[model samples]
Target chain A: EDQVTQSPEALRLQEGESSSLNCSYTVSGLRGLFWYRQDPGKGPEFLFTLYSAGEEKEKERLKATLTKKESFLHITAPKPEDSATYLCAVQAGAGANSKLTFGKGITLSVRP
Target chain B: EAGVTQFPSHSVIEKGQTVTLRCDPISGHDNLYWYRRVMGKEIKFLLHFVKESKQDESGMPNNRFLAERTGGTYSTLKVQPAELEDSGVYFCASSRSSNQPQHFGDGTRLSIL
Candidate 1:
């Protein structure tokens, strides 16, 4: 079974503090690794998609990097507005039914 | 251009009642998907549709759930005789292509009493 596990179920950070969230996975063939940010009552918003190992993508203050067995979401100088649940998902290239298997998510609380 | 849209932002119903959720994907998007998240569990995929055809319904929990995407524009998911275990947030997403990033909607929160 394809599985995604995210560590540090909850994290509290001070303003300007930098940290990284971990997401480990096990799948047959990884087609894509996705990163999303979800607010309390809203749907997840797409952040990045990593296809291969050693690939990295970044936004304003968030960066996502993928490896052979895990992925990391690095937060640089995070702000209060960046506080949300960060989700990690992986899609297997197994077949047409290759839907995403999401992690339980890491709840980030950035105190300003 | 509009992103994916779903109706009934919140729904509260009694057990055994049927509920139908609707989703209108962005114009020209061919891949539509349905997902659900229980209270404290991770979000799980329910089904997927490519245009008007059901590409994969393997994630569907049981036969009580029925999904249809007609005319390849809008989709509906109906749960008959709903149970308390089915209470959760139902999310709808759409992607222009198979391997593209999907756009999501502010899911509908379903509560069963």
Candidate 2:
């Protein structure tokens, strides 16, 4: 079964602090890796999709980078509004209906 | 776009009761998916629908759960005789295509006592 594991289950940072969250995975064949941000009592919002190793995507203060075995979500100069749960999911195989295997997620709390 | 929307933001019931959750995907989206997140656990896929067809349902836990996407516009998931373990947040998502990033609904929180 495809599996995704995220490190540092919970993180606390001061406003403007920078840090990175890690997601390690094992799959038969990788089709795509996705990053999502979820707020309390809300659904997850799309962030980035990294398809291959050495690929990276950036949005505002968030930058997502992918390697063969893992992915990283780097947050730079984060603000209190950036506080949310970061989810990492992997889609295995090239099939059109492939489902995503998600990690437990990392909860981030940025203090102002 | 309105994004994916789900009804009954929250529900509470005793085990063995029946509950039905509804979802309306983004207009024109052909792909719809169902997922659940148990407390302290990762979000897990339950099923997928492509234009009213069951594209994949490998993640469904058991026969007690049934899902349907009639007319390819809206979908519903019904859990009969729900167990206490079924307590969790059920989310619905949709995308333009399989390769596109899916947009999610706020989710229906179901608590089975």
Candidate 3:
């Protein structure tokens, strides 16, 4: 069975603090890994997509890195406005119909 | 271009009742997807449509659920005889291509009494 697990169900950091959230998975094949940020009462906003191990993508203060079995979303000097639930999802097949399997997500709180 | 949009941001109905949720995908997007998340659970895929055709629906729970994308545009999901376990957040997403990242809507919160 394909499954995705996000570690540290919740994380709190000071305004300038930096940390990383982990997402581990077990899938038949890794087509792509997606990262999203969801604010309260809103849908998830697309962040990054990593297709291979050792790949990294960055946007503003957030950076996403991928590995064979896991992915990490690293936040640098996060601000309060950056607080949101971070979700990690994986596509299991290389085909067009590949379904997405998502993790429970990690809730982040950045205190200013 | 607008993002995916879902209607009836929240729906409350009694068990055994029928509820319909709608989703309008981004303009020119050919791939639309439906997902649901129950309390304390990760979001689960329900179905996928590509240009009014059902590409995959293996994640659909049962026969009571039906999804349609009319005219290769907006889509609708109808749940008949809703059960208590059916209460959850239903999200709609769309993408231009299979390999592209999906954009999501605000989602509809369904409650079955």
Which ranges of candidate 3 are over 4 A from the true structure? none
lDDT of each: 0.94, 0.95, 0.94
Give per-residue lDDT, candidate 2, residue B44. Answer: 98
lDDT of 3 at B17: 98
Please give the distance, in angstroms, between residue A44's alpha carbon in candidate 3 and its true position after superposition: 1.0
For each candidate, what TM-score against the reference? 0.98, 0.98, 0.98
Measured by C-alpha RMSD in angstroms, how accurate is candidate 1? 0.8
Q: By lDDT, is 1 or 2 better?
A: 2
Worst 10 residues of 3 chain B by lDDT: B94-103
- Least accurate stretch of 10 residues (summed lDDT) in model 2 chain A? A92-101
lDDT of 3 by residue, B1-113 (tens): 88899999999999999999999999999999999999999999999999999999999999999999989999999999899999999999999988899999999999999
Instruction: Report how far off residue B92 is in candidate 2 (Å).
Output: 0.4
A23-82: candidate 2 lDDT, tens digit per residue:
999998899999999999999999999999999999999999999999999999999999
Provide per-model DockQ scores: 0.81, 0.85, 0.85
Instruction: Give the per-residue lDDT digits (tens) of candidate 2, residues B1-113.
Output: 68889999999999999999999999999999999999988999999999999999999999999999989999999999899999999999999999888889999999999
